[model samples]
Target: MEILAFIYFDPMYFVYVGPALLIAALAQWKVKSAYAHGNKYNASSGLTGAQTAQRILDAYGIGNVSIEAAKTFLGDHYDPKHKVLRLSPEVYQGRTLSSVGIAAHEVGHAIQDFKVYAPLAIRNGLVPMASIGTQFSFALIFAGIILSSWMDMPGARYIAVVGLGLFGATVVFQLINLPVEFNASSRAREILQQQGIVTAAEDKIVGKVLNAAAMTYVAATLTAILTMLYYASIVFGRRD
Candidate 1:
């Protein structure tokens, strides 16, 4: 019963998850700073983000993909099923280092699709479970806690275990996503250099932008992992 109170106010939970929260905050700041700085410097190629994406697609002989302008800020993504690269207004029209760099990163995912990258496929497959976990995992966990702690129901702890397992899928998805994102950024940097889309010096700025963006994903992964561990410790610590 005392352990159940940790759900609302647990110093140990902070001990498990505090560093991840700090990292997430720092990663977010780094992303904003790098993006803002990169946006100020135009790529020497004089191409808009859309054109840059087209250039990369054409270079790779990947003609099936279509590029579209997205309305949301920082909403850039590659939809492999539809073969569409959606870039935010800033990345689709800005012509700055951040714009083309982000566009190229999305294009990198398109290239992964064209090449049938295994990790991307795995991540895609995990999407359903991850979605379910994101929506219901915590609800189930809290419900189990309520039942076992307040009602003393038999087998209620197993409900929490199930919830934890579901949340584990989300964790696994984030873990697999790290390589996919890093690989896409790697591809973007290489192609940007090979095609001379950015000068050697400008590529450094692009690298910072992409690396900062990757850090956000790293932070998210850490958060998910630590969160799972925190709940696991609580769930398993209780004596039924």
Candidate 2:
């Protein structure tokens, strides 16, 4: 009980806990604000998400990729495995600025795939491990600490270290994701402008929507990195 209490009150733990929650809340706010603004401006192009995706793909000369409509909202994504682009129902059918901006974002992934973007490739490779890391890292760390208390050995420290390493993978992946997402948004904006798909007035709204959406990913990455640092400090700092 004493050890656990000590760990709980450890200054490093508070450091990690505070930033993680703050970043998460910021991400949520940015996502909601972007979505709302995009919906409000709506596009004059009359191009559904599906159409926008197709146009972008075609412009990039990516004839091999396929675009499909998804059933969820803001669920648009590109699957490199199948070379398919999936857009959520709202995006697939809606002709709003938000929908078009988002649609272009997915298409940007297709462009990345065609060009073999290094960051996207790295992110793809890390997805499976990161997914597992998310599930087990925290659990293992907590269990290791408890076991260490029960057995009176340093096994808890070892376990916590391993957990921290796994969680670190998640942070690395999130960092890589930041560039990929931001680049995709940049491509989307450029394509929208180049193709005259949106007028000058509408372009402003598109930029706002894309920028807001990008903030969510930035927030997520910041939170992940901060979390890794927090755990590392707790497990290792106390040893000295």
Best by TM-score: 1
Cα RMSD, each candidate: 1.5, 2.3
TM-score (C-alpha, index-matched) for candidate 2: 0.90
TM-score of each: 0.96, 0.90
Give the C-alpha lDDT of model 1: 0.92
Model 2: weakest 10-residue lDDT segment is 231-240
Give me the displacement of residue 154 in model 1, in angstroms. 3.7
Give per-residue CA lDDT, model 1, range 20-73, as digits (tens).
Answer: 999999999999999999989999999999999999999999999999999999
Q: Which ten residues in a row have the lowest lDDT in candidate 1?
A: 1-10
Q: Which candidate achieves the best lDDT against the true structure?
A: 1
For 2-55, candidate 2 gives per-residue lDDT tens digits of 555655575655566677677678767877887888887657777887898888
Model 2 misplaced regions, further than 4 Å: 3-14
- Per-model C-alpha lDDT, please? 0.92, 0.83
Q: Please give the RMSD of candidate 1 to the true structure.
A: 1.5
Candidate 1 segments whose C-alpha is farther than 4 A from its true place: 1-4
Structure candidate 1, residue pairs in collision: none
